[model samples]
Structure formats: C-alpha cells, structure tokens
Target: MAATLDWKLVVDTHDAPALADFWAAALGYEVEDNSALIDRLMTAGQLPEAAVAEHNGTRIFRGFAAVRHPDDPYDEETGIGRGRRILFQDVPEPKTAKNRLHLDVHAGPDAREATVARLESLGATRVEEVNKGPAGHWWVMRDPEGNEFCVA
Candidate 1:
C-alpha cells in the first residue's frame, strides 16, 4: 500500500541549473542534490562521465533539476528532497500554447500589481488581464519559457 502520493511540478527550461537557482530565491526553496544518485549511476556505468554537470558547487543532472523550500523535509546528508518542490527539465522545443496545469498566486488583491511588476522584472511577463464585476481580477503571465501562470 502507498502512504501517499507525492506531487512535484516540473517546468521545461533551457537552463535547468539557473532556473533552479532563480526559483530557489523566488520561492524560498533549496535546490536538491543529486550527487549520490549520479555517483551510483556512474559506478554502475549507467551514466556517461560527461553526462553530469556541476553548477554553483552543486552536482546537476544533464537535463533536469529540482528545488524545494529550505525548511521542507530533506535528507540531512544527501539532500535528495521533498515538499513544495519544482523541477526544471530541459526540452528542445519552445512552449507553444497554454499550460495544461498552471499555478494561481493568491497574494492579496492590493499587492497584485506590484507582485506582477516584480515577477516581470524577474523574467515573467504579463500576458493577459481579466476582471469580472465584483470579485474578479487576475493577470495571466508567461514565465521565461512561455508557460502560463496566473496572479490573482
């Protein structure tokens, strides 16, 4: 039997390492370390020596990496992580349409505009805005990879 289902959201990125860093700051998450896995794979000859890369003193997988909130439960030594995580995976093609699942940021309404501006400065762009009568207003924005996420 399974204890629970763990969910991690992954976004396609061109630079998984840099994006992991950016999201670490933006979301107060810690980047996961994959060195042990890499080492084991290398020892088994499953991964080529050149397939692993390092950035900012962290061992990186060739096309994917993840970050989690620092306080989230993580293995003390290995730092193979869990909780409120986002993984960045490299994909050759650009994002061409809407995201099947998107994040809705729920900061207070008064903070929306400033938050939008801040995210814009962080490489996210406001793509659409919608308002409906009394309790409706949101800005649909695209991240650097063109994935849609909303701020409401």
Candidate 2:
C-alpha cells in the first residue's frame, strides 16, 4: 500500500516576513496569522518577547512565516492552514545559486504575460524566457530573495 502524507514547501530567506508577503501577493494566498497561538504562548510565559514581532498589527513568529492557499481549510484558533502551504524560515546566508527544484505557476496560455507583469510588480525579476517550440513557453523568474520559479 502507498503511504499518504500532508506537506508544505519550505524556503529559506534572510527576511521571512518580507518574502512571505511577496509570495502571498504573487500567489493570491493568505498569510497564516498564528497570532492567537502566539498570544497564548506569550501570556503563559512559554515564549519570549524577543521571539515575536508585530506585523500589520498582528503578532507573528519572529523567524518564520507562512502563506496558504486561500480556499484551504485552517484552524481558527491557531491560524494554521490544513491544506496547501508554504513556510518561510529565516536563514543568515543569501541564495547563492540556481534552485535545483523550482515551482511553476500556471496562468494558462493567454494569461502568461499579465501574470509575469503582476509577479514583476510583486518583486519578482525576470531572469529569462524559454520557448520550447511546440512544447511550450515559460518565463524564468527569481523571487525577492533570489529563489527561482517559473511562470507559464
């Protein structure tokens, strides 16, 4: 029998909040709140004050953030998504090379240009465009933190 698992994509960045905001805008996803949980931890003295930060009037994890699909189910109390999610974790070093594995955003055949423009406005830089002839075409882009992903 095959095993089933729930998963999320994790990305390392120098600034987790900024990258989380950028990706949330790019994918039309919602930023996971986690404020309620943070508040509980803080009140119980289980979490230090230095381990949290206020973002747009909400308390969030200091070194981590996440974005989730808009329609996904999530926990109301904890603000954690129960479906598709991307977690951004803080790391000291900057991205140094091309990503071996990258995400491909599908915008259908006609919406590619508009999608690329929107992504560019959201802090993604176009690295190059690839035309595979009969196969298809896609634009390679780097996110704000230099992680690569494709828009097709």
| Candidate 1 lDDT by residue in tens digits, 83-141 | 56788998898777778998787666999998888888778888999888598899998
User: Candidate 2's residue-wise lDDT over 1-152, tens digit each?
Assistant: 44323469999889898999999999999999999999999999999999999887889999899999987788999999888899999988878888988999999779999999999998999999999988989999999989999999
CA error at residue 21 for candidate 1, angstroms = 2.7
Q: What TM-score would you give candidate 2 relative to the actual structure?
A: 0.94
After superposing candidate 2 on the true structure, give the runs of residues whose Cα lies further than 4 Å from its correct spot: 1-5
Q: Which ten residues in a row have the lowest lDDT in candidate 2?
A: 1-10
lDDT of 2 at 31: 96
Candidate-wise lDDT, in order:
0.79, 0.92
lDDT of 2: 0.92
TM-score, each model?
A: 0.80, 0.94
